[model samples]
Every structure is written in structure tokens, then in C-alpha cells.
Target: MTAITINFNNVVKLNVDQFYQLCRDNPDVKFERNQLGEIIIMPPTGGETGKCNASMIADFVIWNRQTKLAEVFDSSTCFKLPNGSDRSPDVSWIKLERWNVLKPEQREKFPPIAPDFVLELMSSSDSLSETQAKMQEYVNAGVKLGWLIDRKTRRVEIYRQGQPKEILEFPTSLCGEDILPGFVLDLQIIWN
Candidate 1:
């Protein structure tokens, strides 16, 4: 689907408060705002996508429960990036210390902190270029690590700060490295 950008030339651009209110008014819609002041309205994920997304995040959830080194967030949690964009990565994690630096109000609202790690699942409706750009944005906003997984191609693009993206084809499992210490994502976990 082609995304529509709100034309600010003829229309008044929404301030952050207005944008937040607009989101609150539309409970059923998923929304995102880029640094360019463009609003992205995303269609709800299909059942298959939702299932796969759940599977993709299960490992992180369990690991966070055990180690509690970081807080894990599902797709529904929105974060305010340092660049002033509101984004929701499919699966996100923030180190415990970083997460606690926010005031209670900040934690309750869209927290103004970039995640340390982010994972994005490419749905059929998603634009691959857009997804890749979003990953780059995460890196630019200080995300230490990010992954863009394309199940159809069975390819994974790993993003690391100050490093070019590393692409892997048909990997068996993913190593979390020092960022996640001892956590591994098994490729086989994705249901057929």
C-alpha cells in the first residue's frame, strides 16, 4: 500500500501534543511519525503476521523474564526517538539502567529514549526499503543493535552502530553477542 504523507504546506502540521491526541482519538489505528513530520498510518497486521511476530519475540520475552537485564517491549509500545520521531519497532529492548533514567511520567507516556536493540519483521504489506531505512534510523538514533528479518527470503540484516550492515542467508540461529549475553534466537522457532 502506498503511504500518504500529510501535506503541511496547505495543512497545519501537528505539534506533538496534537499528534498524541489524534492517536488517542483513533484507538484502532496504528500510527508513526517520521523526523520529517510525515505521519505514517499503518494497517493492522494480518493474522499470519501477528502469529509470526509473536513467535519472533517469544525468546526475548523469556530471556528478559529470567535475566531482567533489560525491559522488552512488544510492537504496541511506541518510543520517541532522539530525532523527534515516534516509532514502534516490532520487538524492542532497553537496558535496565537506561530505562530507569526516565521519570514516572515519561515512562507512562511515549518514553523519549531509543531502544538498545530492535527487531523488525517484514510483513507482506511492508516496504523493504522503508524497513531498511527505519533500521538505519534506529542506528542513527543510538540503537546499539537491530535486525530486519524477512521470512520470505529467509534473510536477516544485522545493524550495528559504526558498522556496515551484515547480511546472513538461511541462518540456523542468531547470536545475541555481548549486547544480550547468552541469548540466542533460534531460526527454527518460526512455525511453518
Candidate 2:
């Protein structure tokens, strides 16, 4: 896909939940916006890039599962937030109890509920400040933990509730800490 090719002219601002419905109504399109209301869309992928970072996230999830951690998603789908935003983070997960509260129907669509944890893999086209702002939104929206993974610098920024963010540089490992308890992601494999 030729990234964000949609012309978002005259599309009034939409809230997160409403945005989700828009996507469902228009399956051929994708949407995303910043807090300032700049909307963008991209063409559906034809799989021309072979594999992306999302695939590596799958590998990581499998590894997490083997260690008894239930990691649910790896960019398999995008999430619609209440702020008229649709984002496909590198990976995201919810704790069992909180996820169980969803009605069967809501569960199917994976409602705009905040994830217990979210991970964003920084792509070359992504801006650092913008990504950080997105992470902040997740945190403010009730996400318990978030990670901004930068493969270029091989560093990871860990964001936790009610605490200052922590950054881990290359040659180091990233831990789930309180979020997944004992789960560790070896940064070397992620960049490889």
C-alpha cells in the first residue's frame, strides 16, 4: 500500500467510537488522526512488503505465551479509540479480568477500551514526538503500561501508571515488570 493515500476533505471530526463505526461501514478504508484532528488514510495492503514488524511481534507473543504470559494481539487488527482515532500499535494486550467484562458483541469488535498494555514499534516514517503523544493518550485513557520500541536506536521507553517513564538502551533487555511479571523481551532479537 502507498501509505495514507486517502483525501480526508470535509470529513467532520469523529469521536473514537464513531470512528470505529465509520471503518466498519467503509471496509475499504483506514483512518487515523492526531489530537489536532488531522486525518489520514492508507490503501489496503497487498502484502508487497513481504513481512513487517508486526510479524516479529507475533514471534514475541508466542514466546511470551510459552512463558505463561497471555499476550493477545500483534497488529493483526487496528483499534478505534474514542477520539476518532484508529491506530495499529505493534502489539497490545488486556488482562483477563478486565477483558472479560465486555459483552459478547463488544468483544467481537474489540471495543475502544484501553488495553492493559500497548507497544508501538517506531517505523522510519514515524515521528518520535507524535508516537510519544500517542503513548501518552493510551496512558491517560487508562492503559496500565506502554512501550515505545525504537528498533533504529535499539532502545525501549517504558511507561507505567502513576510513575515516571523509563528508557532502556541497546545491549539491554526489556522487562514486563509489574505488567506481565517476570516476562522479558530480549531487545537483540527484536532488532535482528
Candidate 3:
């Protein structure tokens, strides 16, 4: 199933706390909020997508463990962006220094800061346009780098702050660039 967006802007606008509660109340449901306060109900990804996501997350975790420069987060972790949107990238990372600045309590709930890097793996149910828009939102929210990997099309859209997006066709691998510092992702596991 695809995601369904419900606009409650006309009736009742949910504040941050209310949105958090709504998510908490529905543990089984995956929800996201746009900058306009519209609720997006996302469906669970297919097995292939889940496996690909796990592989990508494992790579990030291994790199983070070795470098200890950033904190890695899986898809379940959400971030409250500067533009008031709540987003959860498939795999995300924040510089340790930036993460350490948040109070202990702040770390327990949705993080109120943008991540340094984000990776989004597209699923069959996702819309390319919507996903691209989401990636742009991440850039606007101060994300240093972002990757939108489309398995179906075998393409990757790279987003960098203050620069236009770069699209690559069937890249065998991806570098973390300066933001990740020495990290690289092998796309073989994702592609085949």
C-alpha cells in the first residue's frame, strides 16, 4: 500500500507534543508530518526493501563504530526539523558534537536537530516525486548530505546543501564524501 496524506490544517492543527502523542498512541502505525502539518501514513516496506535497508544501516553502523565520529540512527528514529516537519530517513547520522549538545531528555524523544547525513531507500509504494521532495526538505533543514537510492530505476540522487542535486545511474558504490569522512557504501548488496 502507498502512503496516505491527511490534511488537518482546516480543522485541528496538531502541535509537536500532540503529534508525538499520536505516534505514541499508535505504535503499529508509521506516521510523518509535513511542514504544513499534514499527516502522512506510510505503509510497511516489502521484504526486499527491508533487507536493503538493513544492509545499508549495517554499513553505516560499522563505519560509525570504527570512526566514533557520528551517532547512527535507524529508520525508526524521527527528527523534528527546523521547518517544523518530522522526518525519518531510512538511515541517518549526526555528528557526535552536535548530538552531544542536546539535553538528555531531548535525546529520549524525537531529536530536535537535523542530521548531518541521511539515506533514503525507495520502496515500491513510494512516489518518486514525493521522495525527491522529501530529500529536498532534508537539505533545507540543514542536512549536510542526503542520498535517495531508487532500486527500481538503479539511480541515486545526491543532495548537498547549497548545491543542486546530482543524479547517478547504477553506481557500483557511493562515497561518504567530506561529511562522513572515509566511509563508503557498496551498492552490490542493494542492487543484486
Clashes by residue pair, model 1: none
lDDT of 2: 0.68
Q: Could you give candidate 2's per-residue lDDT for residues 36-100 as a string of tens digits? A: 55656644433312144546566567766776544477554665555545666667877767667
Judged by lDDT relative to the true structure, which candidate is superior, 1 or 2?
1
Ranking by TM-score: 3, 1, 2
| Best candidate (score: lDDT) | 3
Question: 99 in model 1: Cα distance from truth in Å?
Answer: 0.5
lDDT of 3: 0.96
Report the C-alpha lDDT of model 3 over 1-192, residue by residue, as the tens digit: 999999999999999889999999999999999999999998999999999999899999998999999899999998999999999999999999999999998898899999999999999999999999999999999999999999999999999999999999999999999999999999999999
> What lDDT would each prediction earn against the true structure?
0.87, 0.68, 0.96
List runs of model 2 lying over 4 Å from the truth: 1-11, 15-18, 25-29, 35-38, 42-55, 63-71, 80-84
Off by over 4 Å in 3: none
- lDDT (10s digit) by residue, model 1, range 31-124: 8889887888877777877888898788899988999899999998888899988999999999999999999988887889999999998887
Specify the highest-TM-score model's number. Answer: 3
